[model samples]
Target: MIWTFVNNTFEPEEKATLQTGDLALQRGYAVFDYFRTVDHVPLFLEDYLDRFFHSAQTLFITIPHTRSQVRAIIAELIKKNNLPESGIRMIATGGYSPDSYTPVQGNLILQQQPLQLPDMARFERGIRIMTYAYQRDLPAVKSINYLMGIWLQKQLTEKGLDDVLYVQNDLISEFPRANIFIITNGGTLVTPAHNVLAGITRKKILEFAGALLPVETRDISVAELKNAAEVFMTSTTKRILPVTEIDGIRIGSGTAGPLTRQLQEQFIRLQESVTTAPYSRA
Candidate 1:
């Protein structure tokens, strides 16, 4: 089942006022955010919503709903549909423009669908990753323009890899769909700085692991990763996954390291503590 919201009401599609070409064809002109819930309860929902609004502001797109309004709509949708665990997506288009270069108006969409988790064994055994030379056009905002990820996916598939990690000038930037992190020989947790999207899960891990170990946000080079003690990636869907190999080269001992497992355990415990109350029946 799916629930879609448009113009502050449940709908199957957008309003007739929005031009199809302007909203669908135009690239590099929109921003979006995705989040998942454990059991009909949104995880770090406020953080995700705030980022969504901020992204629209940064891209000069007008969000049709206030932050509180959006939150109320989401809660309504979750309750009406009896959604247990689901993924939510909030999108804002630059709207119908006379010409591709101009922005005339804006539209907002909220979509929710059942959540699906990847195989747990992949996290334990780790997955293969290929490196690609691609960088997101607007690193700060989560936009619909994803040609880079599409291209890398095809290339990585042909290379027999599960995913692709983008590199710029031999410095590891981020994975096509997630953020990258590595444990150096000195036990420092190193990940790319502000050039990539500030992921919600990444932020939580940084906060959870604060001062427990050295954590540094800086540009990590490909060579440094090749010799790192461990490597992993984080996202809303995949909380913490170890990268046992990159480009067919084994990472560390080719297994999920102690630190990665510890973080994953903590993440699960945190999720269980949050409660989700169903909407009261009328």
Candidate 2:
């Protein structure tokens, strides 16, 4: 039986329900963080939890459980579900509001779903993104606000593209669900420092890739990005995915370049080393 954690209780997934008056349901108010497991071990769990709590605070929704308690709950949930390879999503929603608009103490929900990583062919051949001139509100918080991204799906499908790359004020911001990076013609690695969610996978890439190339976290203009030697995106699901085309503009011989391949190889090694033991952010 599929299980989900709803308001401190583990219930059958189908039976789990949130109050209809919850701010999350009433007005789409919530924050969430997701991470994947491999062989029953969660990857970078500490980092995910830290971001989840930060998101909750940013949304003015207080999670009832302390960090340690949340961790224990996650462990128990994982054990109950018995899904060795899956994705775990933790959500904190604005509670059932008296007026249906104001924030209140939050409700916590945890779900385990099938893991859906990028296919091997996508990694080998890379992806194509259509650029959009938009900036997300509260980009730092992993909030439950994917309206624009979801709305653009029809456009993506119509354009035969893989995803949307967001740009703001002439600078590349990020993808709808991932953090973007570029290897400059000068062989430096760079990603945006502001106006984007700071993904944990992005952090790990910066940590590991710094030894091999000069790395920077600063604004990258669209022209500079389109001319980059290699372009890629990082996230829990799409680790070090190459971006071969942006708005039909070819990036580096229209293929995944040498440096992108190197970083992908490095990330593979890191992925293999992960275990169920608690991860240290430091």
Candidate 3:
């Protein structure tokens, strides 16, 4: 059984429906955020909530529920579903609008589904990344505009690529969904400082890695990235994924590097230490 939180209560998935003329449907005008549950606990709840509110403000929309209320609702959904571990997607959309684009009343939906991640072998063998050049509009906000990613489907399949990292000018921006982190030849951890979503997973990786090595949060150029000793990507779903190749060129012997493995191990350790309290009133 699956449960969805819409309006103010939990309902069966089939019963939780949106109208055909809703802005999210009519105009694709909405903002959303996603995070996962581990051992029945919402991971990085504060950070995800912060980004959610920031995205809402970026769209000039207001969520009707308070932070505490949202937390309670999440806790209730977790308990009700009894899924233990799942992906939670929260969306605050521009509600029913007669004008079609303006925010009338923000429609909020919380959805839970089984968590999906790359297999353990992918982490060991690493994966591949291909490059494209297009920057996201309102780069700071996580909006529902994925026209480019959707448009890249043909190119991705024809090239036999796993994912695409977007670049602009000569500088690399980020992947369509994840943050890029490259290990320089001089032994520094570098990621883009601007024009990308500040992901919670990326933030936590930087914090944990800073204690052990040199970390630089700045604009990374495509030329510099090509020469890096190692490259990796981070997101709520993949956690830390090593990139062994980009644009058909090999990265770091075309295999997952030591530093990337070390950080992935450390991230798992940190996640294990996270508890179920404080983020919820339950």
Candidate 4:
């Protein structure tokens, strides 16, 4: 019973439709946020919603519904889909306009599907990351502009890479899909301060890590990243994924470092707590 919430209507996932005249199709004018459900209950939904509305504001698109309305829609979608664990994507796109360049309305689309998580083995063994020297346009907004990353997908796939970490002017920005952090030998945790989307997982990690370590928010260089004692990435889907190899350079002992594992364990506890709450729908 897979379902999709499209323009406030619930329909079969396959039957869900959008108009070609929508600016989302004609000009790629859209904003999105992703969150997951545990036991059919949304996790960190408020945080994801905050980012979604903020993105809409930045794009000057007025969401057709209030946050509470969207939240209720999500609950209904989960109930109809019957997936206890899934990933939810909330999208607000520039709606149909006679002139493609103009934004007359915004369409909200909510989709839910299986939350495909990486294998636990990858978490234990760590993953390889490819580095590209580039900066995203409007780095703070979660827009549908993934042209650069999609362009580089072939190379990334050919080498069996896990993901990409974007860098600019010798400083690290972030990954195309996640935020990055490094643990220094001196017990300091460091991640980029600006020019990146401030991810919810990244924020929670910073909050949790502050109690366990000295956290620093500043510009981080690729040189420093390659030389760090440990490196990891955070996002709604990936959680905390350690980077064992970056651009052919082995990070630390080329395995998930000690502190990274500790952080992962702590994050799991936090995630478990968030997921166990009873949902009114399920």
Model 2 misplaced regions, further than 4 Å: 276-282
lDDT tens digits by residue: candidate 3, 1-282: 799999798989999998887899989899999998987888889999999999999898778798888888999999999887789999998999998878888889999998977777898777777889899999999999999988997888888788898999988988888999999998899999999999999999888899868999999888899899999999999999999888888898787888888898899888877854564423
User: Once model 2 is optimally superposed onto the true structure by TM-score, how far is the C-alpha of residue 249 displaced, in angstroms?
Assistant: 1.0
| Total clashing pairs for each candidate | 1, 0, 0, 0
- lDDT (0-100) at residue 3 of candidate 2? 95
Cα lDDT of model 4 by residue, 1-282, tens digit: 688988868888899889889999999999999998888888888889999999999998878999999988987888888888799998899898888988877998999999877778988788898899899999999999999988888889999997888998999999888999999879799999999998999988988988888999999888899999999998888899889999999989888888998898998899888777555334
Candidate 1, residues 181-243, lDDT tens digits: the string is 898988888889957988998888888776468899998888998899989999988888999
Local lDDT at 5 for model 1 = 81
TM-score of 3: 0.96
The numbered model that scores best in TM-score is: 4
Query: Clashes in model 4: which pairs?
Result: none
- Please identify which of the two predictions, 1 or 4, would achieve the higher lDDT against the true structure: 4
TM-score for each predicted model, relative to the true structure:
0.92, 0.96, 0.96, 0.97
Q: List model 2 lDDT by residue over 47-150, tens digit each.
A: 99999999988789989889999888888888898888789999999998999998898999999987877777878799999889899999999999999999
Worst 10 residues of 3 by lDDT: 273-282
TM-score of 4: 0.97
**How far is 147's C-alpha from truth in model 2 (Å)?**
0.7
